[model samples]
Target: MGRKEEEFGYLLDNNAANTEVHTKTGSTDQCSQHSSTETHKSLESTYLGSDDDEVRRSQAGQSCDYGEEEGHLVYHIGLLLEERYEVVSTLGAGAFGKVVECFDRDKGLRAAVKIVRKFESFREVAKSEITVLKEINMLDDDNRFACVRMLEWFEHQGHVCMVFELLGLSTYEVLCQTDFLPYSVDQIRDMAFQIFKAVSFLHRNKLTHTDLKPENILFVCSDYNLEYNNDTKRDERRMRSLDVKVVDFGTATFDHEHHQSLVSTRHYRAPEIILDLGWNQSCDVWSLACVLMEYYLGQTLFPTHDSKEHLAMMEKIIGPIPPHLLKLTSKQHYVHNQRLDFDESSPSGEYVRKHCKPLKHLQRKSEGERQLFDLLGCMLEYDVSRRITLEEALWHPFFSPMRTQKKKRS
Candidate 1:
């Protein structure tokens, strides 16, 4: 293997659970700290409106031009926000805006700031995210799933900025660093426990996290950059060891609202979302099942971007969608009279989907394999009403061993 591939393989070599590497303890002082080597540049913005309600715009040549190109608000380094936090680096770019690493002068801490575009729609969504975050914070004091905490929010430079506690690399990054190798069953269990617990908390609070993909799931540790020699070696020796937290509430909504049915990224999106069926917290369970399968299989369970194609792949893998669920959908373009018709005959005289791969490794009849199969089946049930509850999933025998071990440790 080449150097990059070799480094990726390092991430999948170990399967033992490392306690230190999986600590979920949170600290107020556990903020990010930047190295002095990182560079910063000054920012100049054109001002508009009154002193109390000024909207700032980045000066030409100093901004990322995100606003002009994709309608997202532009951000620049060295921008002093709210006379407190100073932008140090662009952390990541997304559809709304960019997440930047900022230094808080008063708190003497580093934070991740998510800057939303000043567009009215974007601002409204961003406001909703803040509202959801506050609700989660007020209710979840113990941080059961280690969900990301919002420090504060404000308007800065024609953007709605949200300050969050800095988090580590995402599960997506972990998979990529491992060259998409299938994670061990033990590791998958650990992640599922944390994720399911988080989702259960949200559901109990009457909220739904419409997006639940690998990128939205993050590790709690700081130094997750596997490029570092020491960190890489240490992580390789403790493969699948991570303390995970769910992030991104921009698309979340109260279950009663029923306003968002088209939320979630395309690949991990639930069937309800695609068929225009009004969804509740159960939709997140379907998305979570897909993510969990991806961890064990090292690939997305359904990989099509087109709605019809995605539905077809689902049928091939999980069997037909329930007629009742199909009837609930407002959009019937993907569903024909509560039925999906397709030519199933293949060259091998067995039905096969062009996108889905055969489950070779899962052919084993081990206890762990059987348990996972059952858990996935429950989570991916066709009818939302029949789907497994997060609480039930937590107590499921698939995770019973882990729960017993955790109890013994406590």
Candidate 2:
């Protein structure tokens, strides 16, 4: 069976059991994994952010002129920005903007330039995104999280440009080509550590990535070539590495003192978000768990057809709530229609009994997979307060095997 089928089957078989599954037959946590070197180069560049709110508003008079070109206007870096960089090619395109190829004029190096239009309030949003990028860049400099490195930010012809380090293929591309390679215990452990470190850093800074998925994770070619067998194409090998640096902060929010906006991909969103419960950084933690699970299992843990069914699936896994967390729920309609009453033992037991049957199959899976299942289960707990903390997760036995292996090797 495929990884998704295996995961679903496991979940259905072992809803209540606490036993751990074994790893791959021949897999050992002591297996040698590839490592990489970090190189840094400095170049003279100008940085800008919102200096004056009033000045920003006044300058916002400029608007995106979509009518300027019949087809999309391809702006070459050397031609448009009068920089020494050569516009190499297009990296990727998106709704908000397109990342294009560029070679640094003075430094003689390759970089990706993200071009965004000038919207009325978009400048403020861009400024906010830049601020987040700067913070992330600083953190990455010291710890070296797997994330796209920000080179610089600038304005050209009423549009904002963000320069970033060029990396290999995205995880989405890799999964599509290889049909989602079965990650060995060591590979999964390494990827999980990188993801946890990234999310933990964001949480420490009171920042929520808001979006977490395979598509955002970019691979470095050397890493992929080392991990997987077979000499694949540059693009194919790039997909294999699946080394992701979280990108796209347009929907991210800061200032943990208050909730800003409801933002996140539906598949990765937490139950609190779907139920409109007052959410916090924990929501991002939940999403991270979903992404990590998807990577290992090759499909979403809570795959559903629609929002209603999705919510129901989550409710089933997490069980009923406590009075304290229920009071914090924001969606009155959802609470009225979907909320379960666990006040009584029999009714709540019945609820748990009914939902518990579907998860029995999870017991048959391997130990690494079971650990992931349990970790996801904890993250997906209905009561947000009862959810797993990042610190707690760091010390999980799921990670212990790898740590043990690392110590043995050392």
Candidate 3:
């Protein structure tokens, strides 16, 4: 590698997460020698605005063109940010903007800097995210929860820049790497425990994550190995660290805040959200159910993007939406004659039938599987009132072994 590239810090793949690799780029004398590294195969979260009204981002080079190529600030390689973080490479990009990996000379670590679009709407979203992150950072000062930590923030060339501790791949990316094989019940249990603890902390603080899909949940370290499975006769990759954090707080809402009629990603969305029935923390639980189910099956339980077909999939898997819920829905077109406007003879109806089955039928006949499905049933309850909260879910039999471990430790 050329000296220039080395000075820019080691550039890895688009998604590889790195850490502690501090290299001195001639611009600064603060940087130390290179240290260690890790892999983050992907980043799927979006960050959106401003910490202050005065610290305006740069206006010339780019909002990623400053406005020429949409709102992204044109990423100039090796550009110095806040005089402390030097941009190395683009790690990922999304609707919000882009995230650049930078070498933090002050801390001797690699950081993921989220660059948000300068558009007013995007900026407002970014501002809201900053508020939520600030509250979370204050509440969890010791970092006990499994949440992505925001180390700092700044404005540069008209873009809101959020600096976070570097993390690895999204759970979805890891699932894809494993060739879509189902995660063992034990693996799911461990992952789910950490997820629940993190989410439960949010609920206790009166906040709802609103978005909880596998793609939004990320591993802290994606380092892994390929192990030959004698039974499956396939080389399966096992993650070295199951530790994960829920990301993308751009959509998280507090209880007293106005609830958007629609929230969460299509497949992970709750019935209450789809029906426009007003929701709360229970909606997050429902989304977690979908995420856990995906981990168990190695694929999305409800793969459809269409809201109507998604409802059909849910009905097929969990049973009919309660009459009260259907009766209360403002989206009247979705119902006819007091039933989902689904015709058993229609092509779409057949498609739903071909793809879905009762949740009980989808699970293997093992005690652990049964227990997981049982907890899922509680979480998937159509009535938000009846749906299980993350607190209650932690005590469910599926997590009994985990609770036992905790008890032994205490």
Candidate 4:
């Protein structure tokens, strides 16, 4: 690895900048394949089937007796690993594997252990997540950034278990429990500020969180209050603390990594990804924009999953895509005459026209609301080159209060 890459534990892919991702490798399954820097290279090697003498020597006493629950690693409540982490209960489960709440005997605290599935693909992705997390831990040892802290990791049996700081409910879980009521402007400000700060920090380090969404954004403490809502004629849940952290870095990519053709959950996907025009850090900005919008509205900003309809909806909400970008896209089937080709009279087309309206319509005359939408506009800019970077977004008019508060504190 180059010195620059070694310094950061990853190098930039100069040749892959315009290298379009051509597969169905969206954020759900996409994982980084770059070699790690010297700092965490051994850690990666150990967790990724330590075959070398140094790695095998370092991981000498660890057990290799892992069994699977369906496709995920099997772990029962009260099961202990390394005689340090005692399983408390299952936190959640998905394709990646299961996250179990563990009692950390050594640290005398709780941690969330992500037991990766045994599949080759899943294990590889988990290794990638570990690499990124180790890099994040090294980069932000002071914990100034809002990304989740991976306390440690180890291979148990065949499962590469990752121990994370047990956090509160994901924003999606809270939003669901609250019956889909949106957050107040002040609340969104606090949460978005932290999220943007984290993204800025990652971008500064040349990492891009390709799958950012509400579910991936979690509260550090999800304690909330039940407040009466006159308009909804029922009680609504209000977050007691707006503090949040970004999670799920299995798809996080360094600038030097191979650019996956598709990334991000469908609703939050950037236009460039859909059009196959290639992407970079700006894609993170676009997903962040969708995420902030979801927090404000208590629902996904873009509700559909179809590519053509999604583009049509984008046109309806944020004006047309620039013809030059349309012409440049490798996804020619989705474009015609330097414009998105779609039937306006079709049922899907009707759905687009019905579900989406101009961004102006979603805003009110209130300064906060106006400024928030204005910021979203800059973020959702069709031209990736013109979209506001998180660093720039942090200084927008909407976050004036955050800046002022910082000034007061300093």
Candidate 5:
């Protein structure tokens, strides 16, 4: 809407040093909110409905007869918008919007543009995402968090298009390709350190990434590998190269903001979120701990589907919730007295039985193993007040190996 030509030059000229990382974590129910049918589309549209000639004009072009999914507009490869970005490919499609790989003609950079449908809810989400990103981006000049950098954004047709730097494979992609083999301790340490820095940066600044997970964490470089050997018989040393950037800020909220009860993916969710207790940055630390454990064990630490079962698994693994925290939680019905006395144990028991061995596998007698457990214990601490803070985690002994290794390499 402003100086279109000058903004393109400024975006491309911006380097990694200017990239800001604002993290977002989400809940299964919160995620599902985006996945609902035509009813959701209408709600989002109603929420974002504004008296704009451009919106009505754009709506006129959106025909239900088009092959696009219901409530979604049709997008095709090679369709250029705003006379700046050309859609090279569709990266992924979600309930409200689709991400596309676009070639920025002005900057000659491959950018990922998230095109949100002109509906009000989608528009609000896009705008909120932009505001958070800008706030975080303004804080750091060195790009320590490795957050996906936002480039220029604009409105095209009836959609709000957000452009970001294109990043490489997600941790999920690497995990799947490697057949879920656990990363070596050293590699895991390095990865966790980077992740910790990102989380620390956000926490120190009073921001929280509610959705930290394998899928949202990605490698910063395209050429780095996690080291996999398909020949099962050969004994090969594990490759340790790693540098990750956290992405997806759709659900991130500030510390002062009203925290959501149902936030973050179920597996990595913190107890505060599950119990409807007020939460803060500690919630992200909880998710980060789960993520680190998965990196070392190649599976989710708590893999239950339902909230009660999830709480049960937490009890089994992390022990019962402290009384103080129990009182703070809104959903105390799940807890009986001082312990988590569940009426039915089938759902919780099912995953617990299978993962019991893997859970035990983490309890090696080695000192390194003990340190890992200590850090995890603090991170997974049920009480948000006593749980390890991001800064404390960075100073934890668990990362000493990474610090020593970095010094030696230097």
Candidate 6:
């Protein structure tokens, strides 16, 4: 059969950015074609295989001797799961679960089926992530946010399969390709605005994306034929927009109810959260600033460190909040001074004293760096009550020029 006529089926086009598929007769042919395209040049040739090299390498490292036995096991598992989708390749494996390649028989579609292992805690987190995704999908029908869309969910072989739209490259992958090059100011603004829109939508719906980072953002190609150069003029000015989709909602939580658990990636975690204080949707606002700073600066705003060092680092940047604002902290000691005392020798006091030096040193950086640092620092304050609100941040001068530049470019 011809390429287009070969038992065609529609998959949840996970590519997000580039949707067109230029098929070839074989994997070698596909590789050859892609090799000639500048945009795809950096992609490892093994990714084109029906079964990628990573899977082969993993299987080779397996202790099992029976080749057919393992294949048979997977086949039986697929059969037991109703065999609606053909297992094509493995996307990723993790402590929590493994995601496999699958093609849907009913729709003739491809999907990433995240298989939840039998561990109790693993299953719980997987279910929680699924719940978060479902909530997000139901909240917005337009799907403007960069979120992975769920195709289907089912249980089989003592595991739960979450079928998701397979995405192409993550921001992590793109960053690797560019060798950690900072994105153009326009690119930063565009990405930041889109992220803000997504966060705003979630906040409006009483939800908070507890984890926000570069790795969670996915890219779509505005022009597949175009080269992957760092030239912003060509990529930024393109009339057609083909990039969107954010993935991994495992740590997301609804803000309507108060949550006490300290959940968030370390570097992105707000100071209130780190200090074991009650926080609201504004925590996400703090993280958003950090993520945007990393995009523009090609480095993390506040690098990760031990809890003690991290607290010290925070104090250095935002400075110790006035006692009036300290009283607004949701923590009992700050509220009533009953449970704990904020004496000079206390952990809190020591953190504040040690961090003061670094904050003053950071003030001596370049103007652009200082501007970005100041903007992010305002939101990342240790005192939640003293931190800048999302609405106030949106009106800040740092973003005003960015907004004007974006409008002019558009």
lDDT of 3: 0.72
Q: Pick the candidate with the highest TM-score.
A: 3
Q: Candidate 3: list runs displaced more than 4 Å.
A: 1-43, 46-68, 231-236
lDDT of 5 at 119: 71
Clashing pairs in 6: 9-108, 10-109, 11-109, 11-110, 14-166, 14-167, 17-220, 146-245, 146-246, 147-246
Q: Write the per-residue lDDT of candidate 1 for residues 253-285, one digit (tens) a residue.
A: 786774643566565677877787767888889
Per candidate, the number of residue pairs that clash is 0, 21, 17, 3, 6, 10
What are the TM-scores, per candidate, against the unseen true structure?
0.75, 0.69, 0.84, 0.82, 0.77, 0.64
What would the per-residue lDDT of candidate 3 be over residues 1-410, giving only the tens digit for each residue? 45332322221212111121222211121111111122221223433221111112221111222213577788688999999999987765554577788999898999889887778767777778889999999999999999888898889988999998887776766665556666778879999999999999999999998878776777888778888889758666687988888777877889999776666765677888778788889989999999898788776677554567778889999999888889999989999988888777886677777767899898987899999999999999999888888998999999999999989999
For model 2, residues 250-338, the per-residue Cα lDDT tens digits are: 54567554454444555576777766666787887788776775555444455432344455555555555544555666655444533
Model 5: how far residue 7 lies from native, Å: 31
Q: How many Å off is the CA of 142 in candidate 3? A: 0.8
> lDDT score, residue 195, model 4?
95
Model 4 spans > 4 angstroms off: 1-68, 229-236
Candidate 4, residues 281-380, lDDT tens digits: the string is 9998999888887777665666654677778988988998999998888888988888889888997777777767788898757789989998999999
Cα shift from native, residue 352, model 4 (Å): 0.9
Give the Cα error of residue 12 in candidate 6, in Å: 21
lDDT to native, each model: 0.62, 0.53, 0.72, 0.70, 0.63, 0.53
Worst 10 residues of 6 by lDDT: 5-14
**lDDT tens digits, residue span 1-410, model 6:** 33321111111111111112222212223222222222332232111111112222232232222122222124323442455877775554433345666778888777777776554554565677788778888877677666678877887766777888766554434544444555555456566666666777777777776766555666544222223447434332231353656566655667655474565555567767755667788888887776775566455555423444454455555555445544555554343342223355766455445433453354434554566567777776656666777666666665676678668989
Ranked candidates (TM-score, high to low): 3, 4, 5, 1, 2, 6
Candidate 1 clashing pairs, residues 3+ apart or interchain: none
Summed over model 4, clashes come to 3
- Candidate 5 local lDDT, 276-347, one digit each (tens): 776788889999888888776665576445577778777767776787777766676876786665754464
